[model samples]
Target: GAGAETALLLGLPIATLALIVKNIYNGMFIPLLCHKADAYAEVGDTRGIERMHLISGIGLSLTLGIIVTVSYLAGVNMVKGFLDAIPEFIKHGLSVATGIIPALGFAMLARLLINKKVAPYFFLGFVLMAYLKIPVTGIAILGAIVAVVMVNMPKFAASQPAPAQGASHDDEDDF
Candidate 1:
């Protein structure tokens, strides 16, 4: 999923190579080798587990070597042609989905975190970015500063004790 999304954003031969590597390692090898290893572990077959591990390492090494060799031999034009064969609409859709996914993640996080007390700061950040046109990095720094100050304010306030109850003004002033 990530490789495919990044392939659209990058449109580089490396991205295609990454997609192929991920498909092989994650899609094929993980299910094929790792699941069998899990079965071996469950059965208390130490020899079987060891064999699986050795096979997994060798298989992964061979896969990587073969993929790198093929990709190098195939050259950029082949990768580019492969990329070009993908429909424009699909490319646009993936781009749009890529942009929206993070926003949805943020919204989900905000739903859990935001409350009456925190809402003001949330709006403040939104206003800073929307109205003031401050960049996100600037807003993040400002937010950090505000957080530090807010956290320390009570400590600073508590550091100085209030004058003793019913103390004379002159007695307090004498200190």
Candidate 2:
């Protein structure tokens, strides 16, 4: 009863706040932060951009809503069946872990998106850790280390000088 009452009281306000934040971020922050040429060229004007953002936001919410609803129902059924079949100790372990996996997934996605350097190797390392049966704590440490190392790798090639126009080189002659 408390949970239901709380959800009833807070849900609408929370949803409203989320929509406001989404609109502000999409309309103002993203445009300012993204490449000016790309944003303006694609959207044409503020009104057009706003419309695009609104449509996209609605579509994304609709899609995610359907997916999450289905997943939650399926998970509930599967978890119920599992609890019935499994030993008490294993059921308890799984019950505890069910609360953790979503948070872990969110953290992983945030890390990958915010730190582009780690994005490439993060999934690969995750697969390797899972397949190799590495302990969860070990996987977390290794993931962090790999992400840091990848993020800090030098951009030496980007800083290299370009050849001058009309400059002749032996490599070019050979080609």
Candidate with maximal lDDT: 1
The 10 consecutive residues of candidate 1 with the worst lDDT sum are: 5-14
Clashing pairs in 1: none
Output the number of the TM-score-best candidate. Answer: 1
Report RMSD (Å) for each prediction in the order shown. 8.5, 15.9
Candidate 1 C-alpha lDDT tens digits along 1-175: 6577654544466465555565558667767777898898998999988998898778777876776577556776776777678788967766686689799999999999999999999999999999999999999999999999999999999998997788565766877
TM-score for every candidate vs. truth?
Answer: 0.55, 0.26
lDDT of 1 at 113: 98
lDDT of candidates 1 onward, in order: 0.78, 0.60
Clashes in model 2: which pairs? none
Clashes of each: 0, 0
